[model samples]
Target: MPDSISVHFASPAEMLFTDPQGRKLGKDPVHNVEYNEISGGVYYQESIGNPFPESSSQNDESKNIWIPEPVSGQYDIQVIGTGSGDYALDILTYDQTGNSKDITQTGNILSDITQEFELNYSVVSAEQTKLQRIVNIDIKPGSDPNSINCKNRKEVISVA
Candidate 1:
């Protein structure tokens, strides 16, 4: 088998949570989160109404808690909301000189325990420039197309 390079972010360092008013909440503790990785993508077994924890590494001196490290190839990203409403997943990517890109996945939270989604990003650079990427997942105030129903004790997974 090919050597697999995979890391699990089960702690606060891997997740970010927030309220409906855009206020940031610290990461919350969760239970029974199942992670699975395959050749083409990764999958997570998500329950319902499970809120993720926010970033705890923020301070006055060093505001940015999440750092972006770009690895060439394809990446599969996924996030599911355990709440009743939709949420936002904040993502940021930057270069060595501080050039950055911020992307947000809004209203994409899965209200149902059985529903999930994934994102694919291809990074290819012929030049000698390095790339960086950061991602933050949070819940949105409104909008629920899936109608999964977020209550409590929920889970979501992602793999790349």
Candidate 2:
């Protein structure tokens, strides 16, 4: 993995909701991290329909929420719909090594809003950089793509 973890989603039909516009990611209330847009911090990007105004590792319809130094606890991911359509939600995590895996969800939104996901992530108390802290929390259980981070793949049990 790298040094950032993100929760993001996207839909193709303009957007899910008209008033709220797109998704809003509410971080763990216990963690209370500040939200910033210019500098690197916890910030939410509301989508402006497909064919995004900018280029990214993500597709045109996607919007991302970054947690470069993810705080421990529960995270609430919500999708607000303008009407109704399908959407993809993902938890993009980086391992201590240079590998990544996305925990993804694809579903339909048939109401004003949908709060259908919860991530209860706990992590290691490493005495290192914020970057190292990110690596500590991205725990990938069993054999999966993220296991690329483990030196002894079979011995790697999830502590976080």
Candidate 3:
């Protein structure tokens, strides 16, 4: 059987609190943005934003991508980023004791950031582990004001 997990687009401001009377108050927690096509608008005041995908400079040190509390089992990790300029993908694993391991493929991938790209990966096994990886994408443009930063991003859906 394949276990499934969903990564939703939600705001950081969701939490539940109750008074001594145990009355539920405040707005209902929202996990996804509501869009109204008839009104040609987004209905909610709060919007779910994508995480900023970044790359290290040539001379600067690289940072480890961290996905804390990865459940033990098989997982399909889908990393998506702006496919506009340059990009690289790397996968790493860390055990419960914080020992790190790298599992990145050594060659160019079919998914490149010069356009839009999505890459699927698998986590076959783990020992009290976490996945620390990153899909680093960079966008650079010259002269044309119309050329701007590419910013769409998505992540993995796991099957246990």
Candidate 4:
């Protein structure tokens, strides 16, 4: 069996949230926007890929990507500011008994801020960890994270 993990978030104002695979959640998502011919228009569809398909939908209050059998690895969960506002991001764990617990949370955050932290996870018997807080933001052809001050590494995994 695999542990249940989800990365979910919401903001005071509407903005687009994207997962590693480019699936998006938002009101009128211009990035990764998918057309729903049956609805007669387009919408940002939350897509859960790889091991399994998405079984739930993104609601008005929140949006999420559920990893039912998260492999032993690391991936980025991103927030793209189409609109701007303070937001809360949470990692949640669910038990088979129908209860949900928050594993971690980053709240009331503003964009373009940097802070260091560690996030870790396990699947079956494999555990992995990641360190650092990194952000890549795109401004109106103006503000960008100074390349000299930025650092990145390939996602790391550990198992025992």
Best candidate per lDDT, number? 2
The digit string of per-residue lDDT tens for model 2 on 19-132 reads 111233333222343334222435455745436547563433455666564544444444544445677766666544535555776766553443334554333322121211
**Location of the lowest summed lDDT over 10 successive residues in candidate 1:** 59-68
Candidates sorted by TM-score, best first: 2, 4, 1, 3
TM-score of each: 0.33, 0.46, 0.26, 0.43
Give the better candidate number (2 or 3) by TM-score.
2
Error of 1 at 17 (Å): 15
For candidate 1, give the lDDT of residue 4.
Answer: 21
Please identify model 3 stretches exceeding 4 Å from their true place: 1-65, 84-86, 106-160
Q: Sort by lDDT, best first.
A: 2, 4, 1, 3
Q: Who is ahead in lDDT, 1 or 3?
A: 1
* Model 1 alpha-carbon drift over 4 Å, by segment: 1-31, 34-68, 108-110, 113-160
Q: Which is the better candidate, 1 or 2, if ranked by TM-score?
A: 2
- 126-151, model 3: which lDDT tens digit per residue? 23333333445343434333333323
Clash counts per candidate, in order, are 21, 7, 4, 0
lDDT of each: 0.31, 0.44, 0.29, 0.41
Which 10-residue window in model 3 sums to the lowest lDDT? Answer: 3-12
Q: Is candidate 3 or candidate 4 better by lDDT?
A: 4
TM-score of 2: 0.46
Model 3's TM-score against the true structure: 0.26
The residue-by-residue lDDT of candidate 4 on 1-160, one tens digit each, is 2355565666532333232344433343334453222211122324334343364633335555455544433444444443435566666654443345565444444333322333344443322333234554322332242223222222222222
Where in model 4 is the C-alpha error above 4 Å? Answer: 12-30, 34-60, 94-101, 107-120, 124-132, 136-160
